[model samples]
Target: MMKLGFDGKVALVTGAGSGIGAAVSRQLAEEGAEVVVADLNGDAAQTVAAEIRSLGGQAQHIAVDVSDPDAVERLVQFVIDRCGALHLAVNNAGTDGVRKATADYPLDEWHKLLNVNLNGVFYCMKHEIAAMVQNGGGSIVNMSSILGCVGLPTASAYTAAKHGVVGLTKVAAIEYARMGVRINAVGPGWIETPLLLDHSDTVSTRRMVALQPMARRGTPQEVSALVCFLLSEQASFISGSYHLVDGAYTAH
Candidate 1:
């Protein structure tokens, strides 16, 4: 039998306060890993960690601003200091605001998307990889998007940023594959995350489903399922790979 256990290992998930990040943190803990739930929203992260603990799973909360290099370094150091070894990391933190045409996209919006979407991943990886290498080896999963693989109509900055994520994952994956570390990326399609619908999730999700081959959007847990598998040793031979879970959106 192929066991998907994470015994005696430590897993860190960024943006774990809610949505897919939270789902991944919970699932990883259920599989027997000591999980660090880090998010820019401290209270939210703590809440998720508490839920894991309530379920008899080991978890703790840390406030992390992935866009900030210093903060990312401290996050990795926290895992190393508290857990003694860092085994797995998920750079799942990101942001995408209202869609605007490239010609009208404000500079602030461009900077904002790039800062959290692309630069943040780089910051997390730099620190996480450094710590993982020191402790021998570890695995990393970067949360990219279908936007990372294909161009979207009005998501110029988001598309560009995600494309950068795919490139970064490939380069880093190749660089660390033989050195006891592996890096991969996950591209999620239109999911009904709270982040996607601040006001009307049901209506928004329906609109998105019209474009999907599945005739429905995905769930945070569904995305987390693939994420957990990629984080496990069962995926040992999978590195420098960008796995898509876009509900057949990209297939068309």
Candidate 2:
């Protein structure tokens, strides 16, 4: 394991309540970063924060709905007020919208999905980048998905939102690279997360395995490891890039 230091650095991870987000929060805290666990589920966020504290790591919890721009702004201010600075952020809060073909996808669900997955990242970056500029420099990782780079049957809304995330990340990276802020995106394949489990029946499991060249599902830790690297100085030269931790699912 490559050890990276985050001493005196503050990180904000949305969706830190579970899955990859929770894993990232714990790893960052273990590496000496004060982590803010933000999630729409208040209880889950608090649980993750408390667990970090028990391990003698610094962590705080905030209940937030990322789809709300006002709430995201408040989240940034809260971190500044409590931690005094925002040096890292992971815009990982998102939702898997209803699985349906584009022609059959409900308009309301499409709007709702885009609101959280796409617009939410933009709102977070808007506030997080401003804070980073004031603090000199920082790094940001936006959570996209393998679907972002390819189309999936019955997943029109999700694919569109994730694709938007990739585009947004690239634009922000170019606009702020000189200012010391590095923006990037992570495209994950089928991982062992609750969201995935919810849809994983025997049939789905076979399908997912067949899609990945590795012939298996990835663990949350696997994704978190990549995310931590991006947020660390180890990835100082990296920006405006979409990294796929997809078990070579897109290679074909």
Candidate 3:
């Protein structure tokens, strides 16, 4: 129930097609931000954007693969061209690579995973920061995973990529602090999202839930609450920090 104001702000959320990304997009729009919903799935993006519009909010949709640098450049330009200015962003586009041991991970999957999960964030920040600087100042929330802070069995590639995201976020935050851009990472644990459902079975999910102190899965809306705060004036003094919405999974 802690609604923050984002009136007149233009915000971009990558991977806005579903889950946390979609949740973030909707909340931002409801809070008075003109949201640009970007995702690899054009249909899903359109759907989310349309939902916001139906709810009496302003929104637009775009399809772009963040893993592609050239595409990312175009994405930023698109935002500027359509929105007139870019003041906020959430680099939430990412993939959960197959769970495999380091020694058994496939080379191609590793590269692909890194491309979207890690390099993609860098590419987004590179362009987003430039635009934000021109706009005077802005805030960004990068979606990292609980894996970013700790290791998980059979998840070498994902853990590595997420860890890289945390490091990248910190570096960019420091470099842009004086430029009026604040960057931070969010680490979510066992969120009930497509990424989780697609990769986890009943037994596996239950087992994971059992490990949580909350004894249940976190919702995408829960994660969005933190994301929206980070991109708002409420978190003006918060930057270069890694935040967790993990239900105390790491408490142990």
CA-lDDT, candidates in order: 0.89, 0.94, 0.94
Clashing pairs in 1: none
- Which candidate model has the greater lDDT, 1 or 2? 2
Task: Point out the worst 10-residue segment of candidate 1 by lDDT.
Answer: 199-208
Per-residue lDDT of model 1, residues 180-201, tens digit only: 8999999999787876666344
Model 3 bad stretches (over 4 Å): 202-206
User: Order of all candidates by lDDT, from best down to worst?
Assistant: 2, 3, 1
The residue-by-residue lDDT of candidate 3 on 119-168, one tens digit each, is: 99999999999999999999999999999998887778889989999999
Instruction: List, residue by residue over 61-172, the lDDT tens digit for candidate 2.
Output: 9999999999999999999999999999999998887777789999999999999999999999999999999999999999999988998888888999999999999999
Candidate 2 stretches with Cα past 4 Å from truth are 202-205
TM-scores of all candidate predictions against the true structure = 0.95, 0.98, 0.97
